[model samples]
Target: MDLLRKSIERVTPLTNEEWKLIVEKSKRIQLKKGEFLQTQHSFVVYECFVLTGSFKTYIMGENGTETVIFFTFGNEWICDLNAFYHKKQASYNIRALEDSELVVVTKPAKDVLFSKIPKLVNFHIHMIEKANIVLQQRVLDLMNKTSKERYVDFIEKNSGRLQKVNNKNLSSYLGISQEFLSKIKREGEVYNEKAR
Candidate 1:
């Protein structure tokens, strides 16, 4: 709850009444590794704030291949905004990468909060804008960068996640084969050692 308060405060200060309303409306949830927060084609009723551990959002293809869309870690938000806002089914699955804790607020609860605190709506709009920018940058990177360059950029940007996420998932997110990812990592290590 403290983390939630801090997260909100980072964007906008909350009055005691507003904070209390949020606390009363949100619920805490814990998930084990491999557990799903939302499944493909399901309605996403809650918007979640990650408290601990990591989660990945991905889509499974008809050929049984999984494409990683994005990853969210502790102190981040995870939600199918399209589904949550529009009452549509989720197009991707959100699964725990490790045992995780989250604070969740349902649509009704969020609507109530929004009505009471207009600044909260602005905060959400900012978050959505940031998400869009990140997605656009990722798309541009995939379109313009070579695999090795993309891998290097990914490593530089997500240094914290290198050890936490597996190679297979990272490869999928990078739109590269695992073998290529391995080769890139090996080459990177060699380059680093020589530089040192």
Candidate 2:
């Protein structure tokens, strides 16, 4: 709950009264590894905050492959906002990579909270805008960057997350094969050794 407050406070400060309203409207859930928070083609009514643990959001491809979209860690937010607000089904799946603790607010509760605390609407907009910008950048990177370039950028942005994900998912995220990812790691090590 503290993390949720901190995440929101980063965008807009919450009054204690408003915080109480938020807490009252939210519910906590614990998910075990391999459990899903939301499955594809399902309605996503809850927008969740990660109190602890790791999760991944992915879509299953036409050819029956899972394309890892993004990973979430502690103190982060995860939700299919478009699907939730537009009253449509989720296009992707959200699953716990490990045991997770999450605080979730239902759409109706969020609406109530937003009406009560107008600043919360701005905070939501800010988060969506921030995600949109990053999403645009990711699309461009996927279209234009080399696998190694993507890997490098991914490492730069998600250093702590690397160890948490398996090679298959990591490679998929970088749009590379596992063998190629291994080759890149070997090359990186050699390059580092030579630089030393």
Candidate 3:
């Protein structure tokens, strides 16, 4: 509930009544590591606010390789927004990286909320815009950044995630081979030693 209050504050402080309504409408769920929040091809009926832990949203290619597109920690929103908006099947799989607690608002419930609280519209737009910018940066990095550079960037952007997640998942997300990631790590160590 404290996390929910924080989340509301982030979106533009909710009124006491609004907060009460949100609490009434929303449900908190616990997710285990590797648990799916939304599966690929399933309709995303709810948008989740992460209360604790981290998650990765990924897409599986035809060749069966999984490419991670986004990461979210506590206080972040994680959902297939377009799918939820359009009431269509989700394109990505959102999985919890560790045990997590999430506040979930269903699409119908959100619609009711927006009608009651107009400020939510602005919050939704802001979230969408932020996600778009992140996607644009990710695309540019994929095109222009080398594997080593991407690895470094990943480490920089997701320092906590790098510590918690396995190297294999990190390698896949960075679009590099496990061997290549290992080599980059070794090279990084050497570079640090030389700098020292």
| Alpha-carbon RMSD, each predicted model | 1.1, 1.2, 1.5
Give the range of the ten consecutive residues with the poorest summed lDDT in model 3: 157-166
> Which residue runs of candidate 1 sit more than 4 Å off their true CA positions?
none
Per-residue C-alpha lDDT of model 2 across residues 71-133, encoded as one tens digit per residue: 888988888877888888998899999999999988889889989999898898998998898
Clashes of 2: 0
Q: How many residue pairs clash in each candidate?
A: 0, 0, 0
State which candidate, 1 or 2, has the greater lDDT: 1
For each candidate, give its TM-score against the true structure. 0.96, 0.95, 0.93
Pairs that collide in candidate 1 are none
Among these predicted structures, which one has the highest TM-score? 1
Poorest 10 consecutive residues by lDDT, candidate 2: 39-48
Q: lDDT of each prediction vs. the true structure?
A: 0.90, 0.89, 0.86
How are the candidates ranked when ordered by TM-score, highest leading? 1, 2, 3
Cα lDDT, model 3, residue 193: 100
Better of 1 and 3 by TM-score: 1
